[model samples]
Target: MNSVSYDAAQRITLGMKASDCRFIMDEWLHRDAPCTLTVRRAKTKGLLCVVADINPNENPDGLYFLSWCVQHLNSRVKVDIKRL
Candidate 1:
């Protein structure tokens, strides 16, 4: 299994819509990887914390996909890969 974590220093206040978040999760689910997406509220008001656990055996491209997501969403809100 492989784990990836994404965190934003500030709350995603720009054009980040709920649909965008859902779309990412939906796309992930549609992939071959057996995975789970977890979002948690941070102590800071606007901070975003997201964690994904995926079966590497099932999806070798999981990391690349996640990195792409980060870049794609960067325009809306800045998210960094905290862990890999």
Candidate 2:
């Protein structure tokens, strides 16, 4: 939770509802394992790519928020937060 910039206040800034946030966390816990989350922009098309590697020992909720923020910023962007 502390690792991520998104929280109750940040969630409002990001235009995310409480329920939506919960859903994303749940999905992340079950689908995406928490690890290192990275967001990079493509030099050519100016698109962002979010990549997250799975770390079972890491904080799942924090990684979930990171993943959610990455995707929320650009749905079309790539995401690779899977079990390792």
Candidate 3:
């Protein structure tokens, strides 16, 4: 399985506030947090991931969006690619 590197993870972030997300990543990377990468399959929708932190109290469209960091993301690549 292929996984996302720290460099790439640094580039990927979620939430409207980049600073907030950056802070979270920084904590995980620098502070040695037990950050985990996770992935969820959405039946026919392919996949669903919380790439950012939204208002959990205020469920927009009846969907509660909580804050998510790279820790909760799946770095492994589960797809097959062909060279052109």
* Predicted model with the maximum TM-score: 1
TM-scores of the models, in the given order? 0.47, 0.32, 0.25
lDDT string for model 2 (1-84, tens) is 123332222211222334444454466567554444343444435344444443334444654556566576464333332222
What C-alpha lDDT do the candidate models reach, one value each?
A: 0.51, 0.43, 0.31
Tens digits of lDDT, candidate 1, 2-83: 2243331212212234556676767777775434556665445654555555444555365566666667776664454323
Q: How far is candidate 2 from the true structure (C-alpha RMSD, Å)?
A: 12.7
Per-candidate Cα RMSD to the true structure, in Å, reads 8.0, 12.7, 14.8
For model 2 the TM-score comes to: 0.32
Clashing pairs in 1: 11-46
Q: In model 2, which regions exceed 4 Å deviation?
A: 1-36, 74-76, 81-83
**lDDT per residue as tens, model 3, 1-84:** 432232222212222233434454565556443334223332434333213222223323111111233334333212221111
Off by over 4 Å in 1: 1-17, 42-48, 53-60
Rank the models by TM-score, top first.
1, 2, 3
Order the numbered candidates by lDDT, best leading: 1, 2, 3
Judging by lDDT, tell me the better candidate of 1 and 3.
1
